[model samples]
Target chain A: MADEHVEADNAEAIIARIEHKSRKIESLLKQYRPVEALKTALEGSPPNTRDERCKSANWIMVHRAIMAIKDVDGMFSSLDPEYYDILMKYLYRGLSTGDRPTCDQCLRIHEKLTERAGLGCILRSLSDTVNTV
Target chain B: MAAVEVHRFAQCITCHAWSPDRSMLAFCPNNNEVHIYTLMQSKWEKLHVLQKHDQIISGIDWSARSNKIVTSSHDRNSYVWNLEGSEWVPTLVILRLNRAALCVQWSPKENKFAVGSGAKTVCICYYEQENNWWVSKLIRKRHDSSVTSVAWHPNNILLATASTDGKCRIFSTYIKVVDAKESKTVSSSDAKFGELILQLDLSSSWAFGVRWSPSGNTLAYVGHNSMIYFVDEVGPSPLAQNVAFRDLPLRDVLFLSERLVVGVGFDCNPMVFAADERGIWSFIRFLGERRITSSGPKYGSQLSGAFRTLYGQPKHGLSNDTNDHSRPQGTVHENCINCIVPLGTSGSSKVMRFSTSGLDGKVVVWDLENQADLSEYF
Candidate 1:
């Protein structure tokens, strides 16, 4: 009976962790490519913990960024202005995570990526104007 | 999931295409105009409309590389409209053909196009960097009869031309594949003789539909007869000309995949059949009679009021509107389907089959994968 409660807590923890990280990633993508913002966002995140929780958090962030660019494969590598090694390392993290990070999160991130890429500036400005109205 | 139609058109849609990125759709309503619709703000917005095609538009083929559009018309003219251009552009005028053209198809590479002339000539229009528009090659000795259909291979330099001769032949622009001794690529003009591939004897029956497979290995054809035949291995194999048929009146044969072929016709029957060594009707079901758009033509108003008449404008009748279930159209001639073409890409074809139900035209685009009605022709 005690073991069942612990298992329930573990599931709850996993769900909460995913939800918390997803919201933060979405907010960062609302500003710019979540993948591009990683180095800065993770500047304060632990690098040495290597503990299961710490390593898992970093892996989740990297996974989030990779999901942001998964629609057009090989696009981030060729078009991104960021260092190739960081993005390459992120790909490894996504492969490590079994399931693809949610489609909705990727779409939210892609919408932000389009604005950063400078192809959809007019559309972004129109959206901004509508929100202001 | 709830049952509902996904995509619907605004005007009487005659032709359409999904963009290479699947972000946009190009369509023409045969209204002396062409328009591009993009999925913006979760709805369709007319991106651009160009005043083009002075005469009755025949068909529209989107280029493989970009958003460019090439349209052929019965006005004895063809135009290449650059999607990004501000004004209408007349790309080519093949002065050789005297009558209205039946069909026009762009090479899979989208760099070139082949148009069928009423005079039994197939003219090739290719792009030249100096001119900026595709100019004509005006190849002679095309087909003995008016060209009925044209299809380009998905990944090669091959082109197929089906004509009133009840024959469909293959052509190559850059490299010629002729079976003089055997199938070999030769670079000479003499070697480019569109090797007489497979010929289906539909002289008694009007062959209205023809499509090459996604892999371009086999060809599926449908005609006036209630039969669909698979002409296998069109590329230089001993089985290239072997014709096999599943005897059902098929108005059109859309080759969606290598093995899956779909057809629709007169009996208000919209069916999808698959092929391996033999063709089998995997999904056989009834679709309501064809759907006619308001912009479609009316019979007797144009010429002789007969459906089988040779030379006259195509007609739509009063019985095609299946929208009003109370006044449902009659299913008299269950096998008289004239044409079933999609407004978009024929290869990954999401479009429907079009046919005459009474005087009105009714079109039903089948979801080739699920073998279900995706949309009513409008």
Candidate 2:
């Protein structure tokens, strides 16, 4: 059907967009700019796409960007407060993976982010059921 | 700093209300009876016991003008009490609810009252002189879950409800016979009773408490997720903002003025939030002392503190240690707070004093007149 064709086209376009963003985040990480990589990964995150494939692909890029950062406090200092809620969502997503290193890193960032932002960040991330990572 | 006066009345208090003159207190002591107490020569003396509810009383409110007391209970009923010459007489209300009545409040005019129930409906009750009893009109088929709290607007025609469905809704309760058409200040004068005005879906979790500002221009409510939401311009295009806090979720909220709000719940402390000149609401500070952290003492002192706790001398010897964590020390209320009521004249816009009751069965009055830090808020 024509509807099926449109759906397929949309999914393909989202996948291509994810790949392009991942490459840009990777190049930023390569240049030893983890903060920029993080900002890039978090931009337009929890993307408007409902496709599981697109979401997983975007998460992989975000996880890579988060893990690349060496100085957590230094990176958080320069980060904007507007990204706090989005970053918190991704950190929760990272913890859900059950991967040991990913959870450890996410917890470290979560602790610092909570200290910086206060309790509202956690409540927003958990209660905002519409915007899942 | 605010002056605090603590009164321990029971082992647990479900809800409380103050008499019109502020000389007596009526509170449900986590049971079926309502206890009235008065301060006599610096001691709280039990004045009367009104035992009528078959189950635990859930809500209580004393009308400042009419000097009547209304109470709802888990027994699926409500009653209006009249003080007749030293004896309190109870008149049963026709709520007709199949489930428990969770909360109740009198409208500003004291001619009617609204009750929230587990039946997922709000019963707006008014006195019927012909029938010689109270009657209720139900607002049904709107709430998806149990209604948690109900607040009447200052206009006496608009009612706001908080529900477990994570929605705060406004409805016009303008009864034709009871409310004057010109008194519909917030909505159109011709708006019918039980008309839904607005529904806010800002909270994703159960919303607990809802309150209206003194001028009835703003609405504030708290969620189970430790977030407090403020809604302004309450019409078709109302603006709402949610401010999340780090402490435990609040069970109830009270507006001290147009811009100042105090919330109390699982934190066992009343946290104050105020709006700035731009009307952006933010956490100001804890009206109670800040919570003490456990990282204060070294390891050796911690061991000594533990020993003191084990030897039953924790209060005297290890008063500074965090070992006795079961009960929060230094705070007046030792358990989750359940309700807060203003302590000044009922219709005042700026309240200088308020009282809070908690699950620990303590009622503490906070006087804010001399609080230097809070002067700016007024």
Candidate 3:
């Protein structure tokens, strides 16, 4: 019983942390600070934190941050290349776990990034993943 | 302090316009209808709904003098709304363009209006008193791509049009039939009605926003390449200078004065640019750059936030743990600013305030004096 209580406490703490970070990210998005929001989201726990919920809040932040960038090419130029790696991870995880709308957002980011940077970024990312594996 | 009011309409505001008294506003919520709202008891109340278009309403302009509203839609139609006995009457103008009408603007004189369309031509419409209807004359043979923005010179005779073809052209819109007045202020030997007087190739990317100075001698426009260019009417042909900014593509621009301009776009913050005496334009700084930070939360608010976070309460329409709800943005606008309209009791060139509406469904009014004072230090 005591162990279960401790686990619940730990879970609550984790959730509170996630909520705090997610809130920060959402405000960044609403403020049209997508680059900053992306950085904050990547620093904390996995954005797909609440799987049981209808839609995980972190995924929504990721989706909206992507939407805030009106020009994907401009975003690519503004952000560091490594952020794209984090975005790709979000894309894969979101596609596998997110809802239809979230998945659609992920796909759009993928399409736009690919359209902007073309096949070079994708091919390079694929090769990098293969080498690491 | 500059008066700043925030209206949360909760839908994408495709476009917005203000009435003559500035007490009423008409905006399209990414729909076919335009909703007119009036300020009552310091709150906005819906006064009327002007509905007729079958597609998305793309642009709206309110003529303060004439007290008329002009709206354009993707359905390739334009309507003029005149309020008569509390009823808004809509008159369809013979636009004659086959493609979608993207933007519409009432000329400074209120006697004419210009409509930019996806058909690569701008329709200059004027009232025909004989038939008691509106007729349009096409300004063709210049823009090879869709006309995105059109601005009438302060003189009301010259029209400046920006297009997706990466060209900004100035045309003489002097309709001899409707405009019987002599062109005493702005006229050239070759500046005839519907004549393409000058064209400036600013960028290879799509040109989005264009504006003419109060003096009608200088023109400024923003391009998709994240650049703003200036063109001075140096004799028959103009000399153009451009400066690229490290930001997103500016969606709209408005001249605060002949030397200063404010641009807004996906950045959600208005940026100010200035032109030196040498006619060289350069980036000054961003206005309204301050943002709200969540660093210093009071103990009571944090406790309540914790409970709300634990129970998953919807804050600002954002549900669950997916998005932030209650946290306010630092900037005035929360999304891409689609339009900027100069506001003041005086003339357009001397507007002391300006209003901007964006996709985030927030309308924000900014004071020019405050912004100008702020930009001086930067």
Candidate 4:
């Protein structure tokens, strides 16, 4: 029973962290810093929490941050190579939404990302089952 | 330019190994039988067929010291072949596996071998003089999925395994009977058999090939996600680096020297990765020749031709999508390359030649000593 209490506390901590991260990302977007917002969204992406609500909420925040960007090339130019794999995962998640505009924007970003990061980005995003976005 | 020699052995090859002298070859023709071929009069001639496995042979390893060939198969069995007179005889290894054995490799000392299996266990088998047969000890319950490859450390006591569990693990296979009580190299000499030394979760996808450097200080493995990881300082606080590449995932990897590594797989090419003086590993270049784009008819013409064919205006009744075959063109191997074995003199620290076999039924020998482009990387 005590172990269950500890597990519940852990889950609540994860949910609170997700909300904090999402709000930070939104504030970055409002400050006209899409690149910084993308960096923040991809930092610890597909958050470690297994909670479905937290996952979808994080996804929505990531998607908004991704769609807000006007300069895809400029945003990618400053993006570090370390974030390429996580960004690719979020782009694939966007494509799977079946939302037309989201897919179009994702495709544009995917093409540019692939050109910059190469085929490993696509393979890593698709084959990684442990960290599903 | 590197000298590349290609030979078609069969319709498809699953795995291959070379004799101690590198004179003869043993390969599975994508089937249950293992075929031996010899270079007779400057040509590869069939020598013998070892038909023992009930299912497809998945792995083969030739021990240079003992001159024995060990093969594992999907039939849930393994065989150690020894030559008596001109005929080869097989000794069965009792690998207590409920699922298929995926890969096998003899230890560097040739005293024992390890087999990875679909049963999510690794069997470290050694010869028991009292039993007069090979017996295995299971390393159980650690792996969550099938083990894909097993590589023995140069120290002969440490074993590294790559698995579908998306992790590469280091285990101490120190059997008290076969190994000495005190060792100068490995720090964990007192660890019991099948003790987990370290586990690396660098790859988030299924890990395929795992290999140790000649000095046994570094470990490298490839993931299904087209990334290869190099781990240095195998003790506490190991340093790991992930080098992602721009091609299809590699099935196997080989170390040429302390700093150079060659990887081959579905790309049907061997790519070279090297570490700079700073010890950061990166993709260098492909050993295979670059594919030259054919200046054939444009896609617009092909689309119009397809339209004509749909309208029953067939010209010569040929399908418009003639170029849509699945085989990859303009590479040495038309299909996925499965195994790569170094073709160098045994005990040498540096390798200049290597042989690769693939699903395209071709074995290509590559001599990289004369490659001007690779000299800088070396």
Best by TM-score: 2
lDDT tens readout by residue for model 1, A1-133: 9976876666566546655665777787788664444544333333332235545665666555655554343344445433322333333344444455554444444443333332112222222211110
State residue B345's C-alpha deviation in candidate 4, in Å.
1.0
Q: Is candidate 1 or candidate 2 better by TM-score?
A: 2
- The candidates' DockQ values read 0.00, 0.28, 0.02, 0.39
DockQ of 2: 0.28
Looking at model 2, residue A75 earns an lDDT score of 90
Q: After superposing the true interface residues, what Cα RMSD does each candidate give?
A: 25.3, 7.1, 15.7, 7.3
> How well is each residue in B1-378 modelled by candidate 3, as lDDT tens digits?
343777877467999999999989999998999999998898889999998999999999999888999999999989999999999999998799899999999998889999999999999999989899999889877789999999998778888899998888888888877565655654442467778877886576678889987788788898766678888873566788887654456879988777888888866678778887776788776666432122332333323333443343423433234223333333556567888988867555565688989887878888756654545422
| DockQ metric, candidate 4 | 0.39
Task: Tell me which of candidates 1 and 4 scores higher on DockQ.
Answer: 4
Q: Compared with the true structure, what per-residue lDDT tens digits does model 4 show for residues B1-378?
A: 343778998888999999989999999998999999999899889999998889999999999988899999999999999999998899999899999999999998899899999999999999989988999999999899999999999888899999998999999998878887446646667788888999998987899989998788889999999899999999879999998876668999998888999998866668889999999999887775543213322334433432442343423323434443432233556567779898988768878898999877888999988877667655
lDDT of 2 by residue, B220-281 (tens): 99998879999999997899998877656799999998899999887667888999999999
Best by DockQ: 4
**Candidate 2: segments with Cα more than 4 A from true spot:** A1-16, A49-51, B180-187, B291-330
List the candidate 3 regions with Cα displacement exceeding 4 Å: A1-133, B1-3, B291-329, B371-378
lDDT of each: 0.50, 0.85, 0.74, 0.84
